[model samples]
Target: MKPHDVNSTVHEPSWQIFLIFLRLGLTSFGGPVAHLGYFREEFVIRRRWLSEKRYADLVALCQFLPGPASSQVGMALGLTRGGYPGVFAAWCGFTLPSALLLIAFALGLSEWGEALPDGLLDGLKIAAVAVVAQAVWSMGGNLCPDAQRVSIMVVAACLVLLVNTPLSQVGVIITAAIIGTLLFKPAMDAPHEALPFTLSRRAGAFWLALFALLLLGLPVLAGVFESQGLALVDAFYRSGSLVFGGGHVVLPLLQAEVVPTGWVDRETFLAGYGAAQAVPGPLFTFAGFLGAAMNPAPSGWAGGMIALLAIFLPSFLLIAGALPFWEALRSQPRIQSALMGINAAVVGLLLAALYDPVWTSAIHGPADFALALLALTALSSWKLPAWLVVLGCGGIGIML
Candidate 1:
């Protein structure tokens, strides 16, 4: 099917896009992998905003880039659906809920934190395991159909597990692309479903240039001016720009940036992180908490907003800049073959993530495993909404 045929026949207004994503923002729990599952269900399966292949392609692209993969995908979806306005709307809708919650936690709301049962957060983590498992199972089926692709997926997963670093993930992707180029061949006349991006190459180049300029100039500007705000931007921007795997991989980088500098105390940082897990948006929004909790000036809501914007800005610029060029290149037969490998590798990466942080942290005993299975059944078999399932799991966790 053509790309346009797969998407909504009518272009949605930015407000409508915001509303759609706001619902997602309020409900999407787990982490980045689970977020992808939620997005696939909403856009690909429920709303028919894009085809399965197109969504996978977008995932592959975002995985290759730095910053939060899920948020970048959200931004690209918004861009595709309603142009630039939609991009901002989607980001705000999906991000603000968690960002605000974290900021509140930083600004003394954390004192009341013990009100919730301890099981609630544990339940949420268990639900995330189910969500990520669902994503891996479904995407693995679609993207790794052939033996060559399956082999690529297995090897990629093994490599990611063994190496377990942000740069290692990038290496896996690059290696997958090379292997795909060698192993698969596509017909020259294969049908290409062009992404519905209104951005021109010239505009894309401009965005890319801006991204590079900021990446190079921000630290120098921070050092020269010695402004706390500039330094905050520099720290956060660099953290966002350098992170490859996103999600939890950002933690060490952020800790390094904030802790030793004495911007936030270690206890406050750890507390905000715990609070962040309870919220329902991108983990990158932890930047909001750190900013608000900073000992220096520009702390509070103002600081939170600054850190939030600075960290996510790269994702905006990178997606905007890369899409036009990426779209054109992906239309080629050779590139399509490479993407097949890359997509399979992406599935492998998800699989590895599912095993490590999602599964290891959540599944402590038989009861925890049973809860995850029940959540999975609710998601896959009963066709219950993810938000409902997550809540149910949390309740079950309390009981268990």
Candidate 2:
């Protein structure tokens, strides 16, 4: 289809876009992959906002860039339907429900967490073990199908565990990308239909440049000013910028950033992550939970909103930046190969995380191991909803 053919589709008002996504935000449970399924149902199949090919291409572009893939797709669809206004409208609609829910959770946890039953929070932490294990299992199967990729995954896990620093994580990703570019020769798929959006390459470049500027400049500004807000922004922004896989992959980065620095305790961090699985919308909203739960000055609704915006800002910027050049980039063999290696490396990172904070902190005894195992079975074998599994674990925790 030609670009103008797509441009000629009926444009929607910003409120209409918000309402549609609001319904989705409330109803769309599950993780990034499930959210994409919900989006496809709502937009491509139901509303006919864009063709299947166009939606697939858009998904590809978002996946290629860092940040939440489903949220990025929502932003792109909103931009297609209602211009820039639709971007914020869609983001607010889809994001706010869960972000608010998580923030409330944080506030409540702070107020009454001690009054709660003994193993309730432990159950939540155990739920994290299952959820993250599921992520690692599924991602490894898909991304590291070959011997070469499996080797890369193992080496990446080893390196991250040995170095055990945020900077090392970044270096590992870069190294994996280089190794992918040189080693793997991916089979190029047939050319996809061009994206219907009419964003200019110049505008795309501007957005891309802005993403880089914030990523690099935020830390320097934070260091110079020594402000907690700036430091929070810098940490969350960098986490959002560097995350290549999905929300689950952000665990180690966030734990490294907040836990060691004493912004939040390891136990609270795991509990919040466990609670995050129950909420609808993007898992990145866990940032809101972490922000609100921080021991620092910004530790309330104010901090939650800041962290939510900082983490998701990259998704918006990246989607805007890459949409124009997606057609050329997606067709390249080297880019495809690099993405494979990067994805495999991400799986490794998650594996390391599962061992450290998620497992070491959560599983303390035989009962803990059994509970996590049960949760994993419910998730992978029974194919139950995550919220259901999480609640079940919590209830069992109370009993145990």
Candidate 3:
């Protein structure tokens, strides 16, 4: 996009930006990859808000960051289009619908408790297996291009499966980065000029520092004050702060936090997770569900809002921290090489996720296996929208 297109007040009003993303928030589904498709359709192909190349570049930068990839992309678009207000509007529009839906689901679950039907939740879990499997396949193809990268993916997957700990994801990513640095060498190339409309370095540094402060300070505050709200914030914030690959990768981290603590039961946690797949917007909205469903004082609207904000706060800060430096960072051959390995490992992480909670929990019988195959076909072959596949699977599950 031309500089004037974003810089001029009349060119892209904040309300217009909000409305566009709001529509996406309601309709876009299938997870992060599909969200990208919807974004390209709205911003690039239809509105001409940005060029394909520019959007692709933004996507690359967001992928390298440790947050919700699609939400970060939307936020970055808003930041470029209308500054701070645009960022708020874009996030509000894209996130609120699903956040509200999941929160409502949490409330219903709280009220009904065990009285609700299990069939729908079961179907959703089965559908999630297909959804995550498809994501793993697509991401693996994109990230693991050669034999070496494939090896990285395999090793990462095997290692995580073996270790099977909360810290395993971080370890795999770090190990992959080191191996990548040692094994993969990129050809030297001249650096390009910095892109226009980049955020200031000062802003980046401030956000980075603030992120670190909250990450370190929140736990201390929670302990010192003994505030349940603060404790929830610390836990969710840490989960958001530490996530690398986004989406399903957030699952294990969240499971570790709420399940063992008795904040949320395992069945409810798994059910909410499956239901999150059917919703539009970021999968991180699952935090909202868990917040409302928690068996504590924080289990209400206030809790949902707090969890939502805390989980997403790290994304905003990380994006702010990274965007200003992205121009310089993207030009580095070694960083790019390291990202390649990390990306591959991310696919492996998803692969491991698809097996345990997603696959093992959902597929209990031959009939369930058949339904899962149907869901996969609908998603991968028939090209059905994810929401429809989820609904169809749920219906079929109820019938069975």
| Per-residue lDDT over 1-400 for candidate 3, one digit per residue giving the tens place of the 0 to 100 score | 2333223222368899899899999988878887899999988899777677778888878888888999999988888778778888999999999999999999998888578655877888888888888888887887788999999888887887677665677788888888888777777645343333676677788889999999999989999999988999999998888776668778877876788689988667877887887788899999999999889888889899999999999998898788878887887878978877788887887787778667878899998899989889988999998878888887887787
List of clashing residue pairs for candidate 3: none
Cα lDDT tens digits for candidate 2, 1-400: 2234223245788899999999999988999999999999999899888889888888888888988899999998988987778889999999999999999999999999889999999999999999999999999998899999999999999998888889999999999999999999988776677777667777788889999999999999999999999999999999999899887899988988999899999999999999999989999999999999999979899999999999999888898888778877888888988988899998999999999889999999999999999999999999999999999999999999
lDDT, model 2, position 220: 96
Tell me which of candidates 1 and 3 scores higher on TM-score: 3
For candidate 1, lDDT tens digit of each residue in 209-296?
Answer: 9999998899899999999999999889977886655565566557657876889765466546555666898999999999988889
lDDT of each: 0.80, 0.91, 0.83
Q: Which is the winner by TM-score between candidate 1 and candidate 2?
A: 2
Q: Return the TM-score for each candidate structure.
A: 0.66, 0.97, 0.90
Ranking by lDDT: 2, 3, 1
Ranking by TM-score: 2, 3, 1
RMSD of 3: 3.4
